[model samples]
Target: MPQPHQADGPAQHAAGRQLPAPRTPSPRDAPPLNWGVIAPGGIAGSFVDALHTHTEQRVVAVGSRDPERARAFADRFGIPAAYGSYAEVLDDQRVDIVYIASPHSAHFAHALQAIEAGRHVLVEKAFTRNAREAERLIEAAGERGVFLMEAMWTRFLPHIDVVRQVLDSGLLGEVRTVAADHGQFMNPDAAHRLFAPELAGGALLDLGVYPVSFASMVLGPFASLTAVGEKAFTGVDGQASIVVTNESGAHGVLNTTLFARTPTTASISGTHARLEIEGDFYAPATVRLISREREVLDSYVPAQREGGLCYEAAEAARCVAAGRLESDLMPLDETLRVMRALDEIRRDLGVAYPGE
Candidate 1:
């Protein structure tokens, strides 16, 4: 087992045992992967900034309906080429994979298009409008022998890796209860993206997913779920609270909102200790692990790098070069499982999309 000294290390198995070390590939073992960008949006900007961290990755081109928009994005990020439409990038033989950042409603379509065009995909999260849409992309990717992964960027962050490590070490004892929340105040205008039905806008698909994903990360799939959500006049959920229970009786509480301020906090409690994550729990930040003795152990403090978002881009580059279709840490099954949980939560809350 690694001492407290290796705080960023992978979680060791319980009983003071060491888990297997990560096997690194030699130069002879990996292949080249040239990446493309589809839908130049705000979230894509983060990917653009983060992708610069990897020498192994290249953002060859960008595609959008508005040619000028695509060119401007390319220029801002130093990408080499821009296309007038997504179809062009999908058809580009030089591009090995595509990172998608369209609206939630378009994730299914965009991912399917990329898969059909024989390109691997890293899709932005909340993978789609619902589990059904997510499963569609997954099935198509499987059939096409192409890679498809949800861009659950938080799960790939350095801090989250460290969090997983701490939990597995048994130093926290058996995790008994969990809590996470993400909230923000969004304007109520129907034209705003948060309230626009056309964009598939709402709190649950937006800020809500992070806390829910965090809970699932710690607790795994819940055996049962219950939720309550407050809806906007536009009929979209403005806030939601969900409770999930594991077979072991562990309780997970998650909250998300576009209607209130929620501190954006998180914690995990166990027989021996508890961990309190600071503001912006999903990103680069600090967490305090408290013990029965009231001692505090902090990890992931004063991040060596800001905007830890780039780590996911680096991880994808490594995985693709190593011929991996999906990340070992963030597997396709896990993505589907999260979507399924979200789907059930929406159902229980009486939230339904236009088509549904």
Candidate 2:
């Protein structure tokens, strides 16, 4: 297993005993690759900035429907190429991989385009509008023998690796529950993408994916789930609560909302110990391991990155260099499973995207 990156500051502990430090690699340690970014959206900007600031990976090109926007993004990021269209980016023979930063509705088409063009892809999350689309992309990538992975960057963070190590060590002892929430207040204007049906807008697909993916990470796929939600005036889900039970009887409680900001924290509790991830848990944050008796066993504070999105980019570069088709840390199967769960949640909430 890849060790976690060392913590930023000196290790802090209880009772004057230092806890173990994470051993994940620094971004500078990842193999470099030439990248082409699609959409050049907010998230893409963050990704490019993190790569430039921390990793050896280079954003060679940027593409957008608007040529001027493409050029601006490229100029801002110091990219060498700016294409007027996504097709041109895919056609760039020098581009080793394409990062699809398009909206959820366009993920399938964009990813399929990259696969057919013989380019590896790292599609931003939600993976797709639904599971069917996710499956199609996975199958296409498999047939093309090119790499494809969802940019679930959280899974690749150093603190996440530490969580994995703790879980694998059986320190948690029969994990019983996973709880997480992600919510952000958004403008309720019907024209906004977050509430626009044509864009596949909804709290479930946007803010909800984090908690859902977190639950999936802690407790595999759910065997059954029950959900309840309130819809926004614009006909999208404004808030939702979900309870999922896996085959092993482990339960996950998840909630997401666009109506208000939430604590955005997460916890995994087992018979013997529990791990608590601090607020904004999906980002670069802290984790605490505590015993059933409520004593702090250890605490992990991760080194901060500009945006922490480079971790997934680095993983993608490593996998492509190794001729691998997918990442073990965030596999295609897991992406598909999470999509299925999202689909179920939408069904229970009676929220359907256009043409779904």
- Candidate 1, residues 1-356, lDDT tens digits: the string is 11332454454323223222212232122344678999999988877776665334678989999999999999999998899999999888889989999988788898999999999999998898888888788899888988778888888766676678767666666788899999998878988877876687889888988988898889887888889988887878888899998877888999999988889989988876777888889876677767667766444463444656566666676777676788876788888888888888878777777753
List model 2 lDDT by residue over 1-356, tens digit each: 11222223343113222234665677788789999999999999999999998899989999999999999999998999999999999989889999999988898999999999999999998899999999999999999999999999999999898888776656676888999999999977987888988788889888899999999988887889999999999888899999999888999999999999999999999876789999899998899988778888788888784569989999999899999999999999999999999999999999888875
Cα deviation of 7, candidate 1, in Å:
20
Off-target runs (Cα >4 Å) in candidate 1 are: 1-32, 53-56
Evaluated at residue 236, the lDDT of candidate 2 is 87
lDDT scores in order: 0.79, 0.88
TM-score, every prediction: 0.89, 0.94
